[model samples]
Target: MRALIVRHEHVTEPGLVGDRLAEHGYRLTTVTVVPEPRHHAPDVPFDFPDAADWDLIVSLGAPWSVYDHAAVGSWIDGELALLRKAHHLGVPVLGVCFGAQALTTALGGSVEAAPRPEIGWTEIETDLPALVPPGPWFQWHYDRCVLPPGAVELARNAVCTQAFRVGRSLGVQFHPEITTAMVRGWLGLGGAEQCVRHGVDPHALLAHSRAMEADARANTRLLVDGFLEQVANTTA
Candidate 1:
């Protein structure tokens, strides 16, 4: 099978999700939205590839809001178009964080700023315990997604909708694909300010992340495996 990963920035790799896809014998191809020179910048080229070319699609997180086209450049439009096209084609999508917001937007839902940013380990209510871990997934987003049309919400917190599914597509508000090095890079790149702004202790975030490393990676693998299995069943 083939998987196309739409990577928004250099930091947001597919991580354990990619590893599990590889385990499932998926040929992974990444389409980096932002050019190397503008890796940190929100500006990304708007062009999109044919969704029909891939067996599965995984859209990674971004720092920008789905509605912030002015800041994100033309990529927002392209992403929305891609999501809609994928939906029509019944292509499975696994969207994370900003990517989740993108899925909601493409499916006639809305994205908005949460009352406050969620930054660190949090316990969310989930209906699918088999598919989602209960707590301590790395999180760093100020925005939240509305459940899209035909979507089944799987998890949530008092602040936002945490995870949802529509047909073969799944969207999660947390970063299941995060690694310790990825978290450190985010922290070193001034992400600490956001944590501080959100009343999250940087030390606590790091500590909790370290404590949850084994569980987090295992959960990532499970979710990826679940997603790929669903993809297989759909095409069977």
Candidate 2:
């Protein structure tokens, strides 16, 4: 089986999700939507590969908002179109954070700026705990998904909707793919300033992420297993 990994920014990587996919006998192909030079502000025209060609698609997080059409509208428009096409073709998608917001918009939902940004680790309430585990999940988003019609919300928190399912696709607002290294990379790339703005210490966040590494990996594995057995197989 083949999995198409859509990375929105250079700093973001597949992390444990890719590891789990490989363990499940999936060959991964990554497509970086916004590469190095264009990382900060993506303005170039880009297109996604045919959704029918891949067995699965995993859309990674981004620093940009889905509603920022003025700055990133050019490529985000294409991404929304691609996500819609993938859904229509019954291609399974696992959208994380910004990717989830994009999926929501593509599926006839809406994205809006949250009253407050959710950063660091948080425990969420879930209707389907077996499929979507509660808490200690890493979150770093300033927006929320209103949920597409027919989408079943699996989990939520005081701040935002954490996870949802629509047909074969699953969207999660938290970063289940987070690692200490990834957090460090994000911090280096202006994330530190964002943390300061939110009154969070970047160093402390990194340390906490390091402490949660082992448990995070285990949780991610369970999530991937649940997704394959529950979501993907049922849709198939």
Candidate 3:
């Protein structure tokens, strides 16, 4: 099987999520929308590949908002179109954070700034514990997803909808693909200041992430297994 991984920025990588997908016998193909050079100005034109060609799609988190046209540029619309086409074609998508927001928007929902940004690890309330485990999942988003029409909300926390499903796609408001190195990279790129603004100690957060690496891997394994068995295999 083939999996198309959409990386929105230079820092974010598939990490454990990609590892699990590889374990599931998938050949992964990653496409970056905004490279390192274009981080500050991400409005560059990018041609998203056809989603129909892949067996599964995974859209990783980004530091930008889906509704921010001026910030994300015109490529957001093309990505939205790709997601819509994927949903209509029964292609399974796993959307994380910003990706989740994009999925919601593509499926007739809308994205909005959250009451407050959710940073660090948080355990959400899950309707389907087998698939969407209530976890201390890594989170770093300033926006939230309003459910798309007919989408089953899988999980949520006090702040926002954490996970949802439409067609054969699943969207999560947290980052299941995060790694310590990724967090470090984020910290290097103004994340420390962002954390300080949110009352989160960047150093402690990094240490905590390092400590929970094993647990994270275990949780990701379960998440991937359940998603493949229960969600992805389900027909549109």
- Model-by-model lDDT, in order? 0.83, 0.90, 0.91
Q: How close is candidate 1 to the true structure, as a TM-score?
A: 0.93
Pick the winner on lDDT between candidates 1 and 2: 2
Encode model 1's per-residue lDDT on 18-117: one tens digit a residue: 8878877889999888865785676755578888888888999987888887789887888889988988898888899998999999999999889988
* Ranking of models by lDDT: 3, 2, 1
Residue 161 of model 3 has an lDDT of 92
Question: Model 3, 209: alpha-carbon shift in Å?
Answer: 0.3
Candidate 3, 21: how far from true, in Å? 0.2
Winner by TM-score: 3
Model 2 lDDT tens row, 174-229: 99989899999999999999999999999999999999999899889988888988
Please give each candidate's TM-score.
Answer: 0.93, 0.97, 0.98
RMSD of 1: 1.8
Report RMSD for candidate 3.
1.5
Superposed model 3: Cα runs more than 4 Å off: 234-236
Cα lDDT tens digits for candidate 3, 1-236: 88999999998899999999998788999999998998999999999999889899999999888999999989999999999999999999999998989999999999988999988989999998889888889999999998989999989989999999898899999988989999999999999999999999999999999998998888888788888888888322
Clashes of 1: 0
Query: If both were scored by lDDT, which would come out higher, candidate 2 or candidate 3?
Result: 3
Worst 10-residue lDDT window, candidate 1: 227-236
Candidate 2 overall lDDT versus native: 0.90
lDDT of 1: 0.83
